[model samples]
Target: MDVTVAIDCMGGDHGAVVTVPATRGFLRSHPRAKAVLVGRPEALEQAKGEFGDEFGDRLNFQVAAEVVDMDESPVSAMKNKKDSSMRVAIELVKSGRADAAVSAGNTGALMAISRFVLKMLPDIDRPAIASALPTMKGRSYVLDLGANVDCSAAHLLQFGVMGAMLVAAIEHTDRPTVGLLNIGEEAIKGNEVVKQAGELLRASGLNFVGNVEGDDIYKGASDVVVCDGFVGNVALKTSEGLAQMLASFLREEFGRGLLSKCAALVALPVLKRFKRRVDHRIYNGAVLLGLRGVVVKSHGSADAFAFEQAIYRAAEAASNQLIERIGERMAAMDGVQQA
Candidate 1:
């Protein structure tokens, strides 16, 4: 297998500056893989300049007249920006022209285009963006990062099943544990949605591990944490901000004086490694679960390396039969009727 990936060449902060080089680097490492770079023809040409003969021969591009802006609303933008690169790239996957699609664009627009073009898997009410977060214990899957803001208890149960399947398949875990995002670990805690969803998940025959609090996200209390998009997105952004703040605080503390500076020099490598582990960009991107095809969302400000990581994550999603597995799991759940 040669997996074909479609990159939204014009849809990120860095545009093709990051996408083109990332494609080049991915192809260099994954010789069997191919890419369809979707964007305005001239912008892609300029970005393609860096790869010279190597990429000129290996790559392909599909022209899309427009690029989705970062600030656009999901539903309205997808309806209006039909010629957008994100829309075209997702269309490629839906049409079987590409095995997967990757983008660092407007999260809302990407999710909308994905739902419109690729549709959801059988029995899935809404697709979700699931990310692998590095934990002190290791890593865990957190779903509905920004996909469905208003979710039902049934939806959270679906997330648990699908997310568990994702971690088990892609991460090579056997019977990955599942948890509900809540204010406390007690079964009686959380809002009505969490409490009701907890009941469903506990009875759903999956490996449900009760509830986990916000602090447990990186403590590895569970392999999969299920929540609605609104909460998950807040948690994700808060984690990112905290990670950056902590890194900056450490740097400032160490650079205060000569003795501290000397200690900082000695600790630089370890600190840098730790920072990389916490930065979500290092983990970079994740697959949008419950869709008919693999769709990955990279960091909006992703660089070439980050884009490359996103591509790799997309490939893993495809190879693991993520869509198929999620469908099977959701179908097995008692409440979700197969459509």
Candidate 2:
């Protein structure tokens, strides 16, 4: 399958420095893939030389007249930066020029521009950000990671539906289990919105697994975890920080003495495996679910390898027809609700 990805080259902290190399790396792995690199002409030209002639045909550029600042308000960016790289990249998807769009830009600005350009999917009132996190059994998908801060019960249910479909489509699971994030596993615990959401999930034909706490995320309690953006973002950042802290502690301990260094040498292979398992770079892409088109958000501070992972994720979603699968699931659920 040929997947064409529109890359916002000037959207991230490193901008072309990171995105250009990542695009080249992504194309190397996905031979049938093409990239539309969106940024200033001079930057693209420089990248073209760096990438050499082998990727000349597969790699293309779209000139973006402006760039949205990282600290700019989403509303202001949407209103003023019409020709920004983020907006232009999303426009490629809206215009059917690309299968998916990838950006490591301002999260709010990306969401705003995506909604304005591609709009929401039918039957979806709002979009949620969904991303995969490593777990004991495997990886679990979580949603609303800083997208919609305040969501209704109905919106949480929608997130559940969208997240379930996403896991099903990408992971090839027939009926992925869905769990509502709460303080306790009991049905009665949590705020009114979560309780209502759990009730809705139970009745909504999803594989509702009752409630899961924060630890359940790493325990692989469910394939999909649903929560409001505020809570989800907190959990996401906390886990990231914890992972970094663990790695730092390990490094410090290993460098403490000659005996520790010897132990590290003997355990190098095991540590490498553990590092690969916990590395956030491998799972850098966050899917903006409920949108009409595929838009992946990479970590703003992502390096070349991390951004490449995001590009790969965007291409994978496009190839799997993630948007179509979500639409079908929502339609079926709507039909059942009406019945």
Candidate 3:
């Protein structure tokens, strides 16, 4: 198989109920991809019974004796749940048994276990959570999404490099444009850290666009947007909340009166298209970048389709040699510095 993702079958809200069905759906779509179910064997029994012979060799299982809880502490989990599905899945990636690992478990725990197990890629100081968000033109990748709450100028530069490489691997682009998230379009608008980050990005050999305002994200100002985890996390949560509010407003408007109900019927198709465009479920996967191995974090409450998207994301990263590409870029930077 070109790519094999270890699935944390006992992670997330629905555990095997969602992950198993999602894996089956992902396998059907990606014929070249294989998946290893990692969880308590009994937890995966029903899944094995349902799709055992359907994919046969394309699918396998790695029994994990324990399961990590949704509210578990990273330290507690690591010390107590070594055999947890989440840890075992990451272990598969570290051991080369799997090219990537997909999980919809506790974000902090997943990040901790992954970093502890896989370690950081050479010269990458910290890992970041990167995800694609819908824009007016298309979608743009954003990084440091709640991973490193506090970051230095160098960390932001590293985020830009990793974010660019992620876009390169997934979008097949050689040099994706990168932008700094700031309060204003002007370089002097943000704080000292952002100002220093702007300077570093300018000389980093990547396609560095100047500062972009909050509204510029949806405007598709750049192919990738770079920021520290604090700002990135707030932006992400705000966008989700905004989408929900808008949807609620639309429902309330449509139900206001008979006249509005008639208008809603007339605009039903348009509304459906709009809903599809903004559906958070379609963009459920947030990749943990800068790790030695590929790891994707699915939203904890994701359904089968949303979780399947996460699996597909993991497969794409592995097949496209994402880790190798990022490593090459970092190596090139180091070589330039040495010269």
lDDT of 3 by residue, 1-339 (tens): 379999999989999999999999999998888999998989778778888598979999989999989999999999999899999999999999999999999999999999999999998999999999988888899998998989999889889989998888887777999999999635458999998898888888999988988899999999899999999999999998987898899899999999999999999999999888888787888999999999999999999999999998888888888999889988878743332
TM-score of 1: 0.92
lDDT of 2 by residue, 191-250 (tens): 888878888889899999999999999999999999999999999999889878888998
Q: How should the candidates be ordered by lDDT, best one leading?
A: 3, 2, 1
Clashing pairs in 1: none
Greater TM-score among 1 and 2 belongs to 2
User: How much is 37 displaced in model 3, in angstroms?
Assistant: 0.9
The lDDT of model 3 is 0.91
TM-score of decoy 2: 0.95
Superposed on all Cα atoms, the candidates' RMSDs to the truth, in angstroms, are: 2.4, 1.8, 1.7
lDDT of each: 0.85, 0.91, 0.91
lDDT, candidate 1, residue 268? 88
Segments of candidate 1 deviating more than 4 angstroms: 55-58, 185-188, 334-339
Which 10-residue window of candidate 3 scores lowest in summed lDDT? Answer: 330-339
* TM-score of every candidate: 0.92, 0.95, 0.96
Q: Looking at candidate 3, what is the lDDT of residue 286?
A: 91
Return the candidate ranking by TM-score, descending. 3, 2, 1
Where model 3 places Cα greater than 4 Å from the true spot, the runs are 185-188, 335-339
